[model samples]
Target: METEGVFQSLPALPLFLLMFSIIYLIAYFIVFRNWSPSIRPEASSCLISLSHGTPAVFLATRAILAGQNRGFAASNTVFQNLVLDYSIAYFLMDLLHYLMFFPSDLIFIGHHSATLFVFLTCRYVVSHGAFAILFLLILAELTSACQNAWTLANARKGDVEFAAKLYDFLSPPFYALYSIVRGFAGPYFVYEMLVFFMTGVADHVIPRWVWISWIGVVLMAISVSILWVSNLWLELYRERTKKLEKKMR
Candidate 1:
């Protein structure tokens, strides 16, 4: 009864989007008031991911499990739709941040744009595939907390000893987790999604091009993640080697 009431009174998607945007502003203007001007906006952006990632995983899981009909193109339940709205809101806010502060970062901005297109289509256009997309969201965000921590640590490591140490401590673990997810798990799931979508089982539920685009966007994102993490691994190896050389000298 309580849960039902909660769903009944859940705010509309636009209002939810507004709330997420407010959270981003609050992070930059209030919580990180003392942070460096350049770093603060990015930090606040990371905060929004932290605010979204883990919780979205759990919520997506709950929605997936509670849903009655299940398929790549099955109709979405109320809970599932709500979870999609939450993710859509997060991506939109984060996209705005990148556009405003880091417009030169085409990789992130493009990635966010592609992701939003996929999510928007799933939520509004086709009204299906919440299961697949939300599961992908879970995989994508599984390492977000560690990644964000490492990012924050990396951002300040130049000037702060503790931040440097934290960055060092976090690098290997975060890289391994991200690699496993992006390299192995992510590809596997996407492969499943592609095969499922290709079968035309969802022809009546989702248009062909839409699911194709979703798969394309997902594949591109995974490729980018692999490339991004590969660079981090190389950088980590060099950093550690330099540390060892300095200590030995």
Candidate 2:
């Protein structure tokens, strides 16, 4: 109880920074230090996937356990300190990692920056609708985790026949999951958030500016996801074209 109270009292950004540092250190030790140097990047991503994905799925489960009457809302204590804390921390780390390793990736940097801004606002300024947004954020990560796993495992040296076979097996499901979550469900969640604000349907009092800020952030998230999904589809299309040519030959 005391610990929970302390967590509740702590400011959101500081808490996020603290949690991110911890997760970064752990990921460094697990991925960079211990993994194959060739696959370090993928391993680092894998660590992040497990760290964030596990908890998001767990929180979703807890909500399931709590039963269906619980409509999507801003999290309660356990959800906030446990789930949201870790989430913001992961985003912070992800943002920094991209800045350091792939500085040219401006799109990702912008996505992370915009997301961090909304999270910080929820922590400090907004009083309502955060849980719904956070839930969506984490839910998206669930598919990301699986997608990363598939990518990392596929990035192996192998015979051409075996590699092509593996790629064919894995690519469809991965794209399907990505499409369903980031493409389809993502827009739905954004719509829900919009409705929450437009209809004055939040769980707490949301100031006008806060509402505007939150809606903008959600829109940004949706925009990025659309771009990402488009890229995935393009890759899938090219892969199919290559296979058709090989068959014709």
lDDT of each: 0.89, 0.66
Query: Which digits, one per residue and each the tens of the lDDT, describe model 2 over residues 1-249?
Result: 686676567675566566666766676675467556656655575667576776767765564444333444443444454455566777888887788777897987888888777766665555334456556765577676667656655664243456456666777787787777777787887787677667666535566677677678777777777787688779889978998999999
Evaluate model 2: give its lDDT: 0.66
Q: State the displacement of the C-alpha of residue 176, model 1, in Å, after optimal TM-score superposition.
A: 0.5
Q: Which stretches of candidate 1 lie over 4 Å from their true place?
A: 1-11
For model 2, name the residue pairs that clash: 74-131
Per-model C-alpha RMSD: 1.7, 4.0
- TM-scores for all candidates: the values are 0.94, 0.76
Q: What TM-score, to 2 decimals, does candidate 2 have?
A: 0.76
Collision pairs in model 1? none
> Which residues of candidate 2, in runs, are more than 4 Å off?
1-3, 6-39, 60-78, 154-167, 201-204
User: What is the per-residue lDDT of model 1 for residues 1-249, given as tens digits with 9 covering 90 to 100?
Assistant: 587668758775777689878888899899988989989998999899999999998999898898877677788776888888899889988989989999999999999999999988888888888989899999999998998998899889999999999998988889999999999999998898888988888988899999988989989999988999999889878988998999999
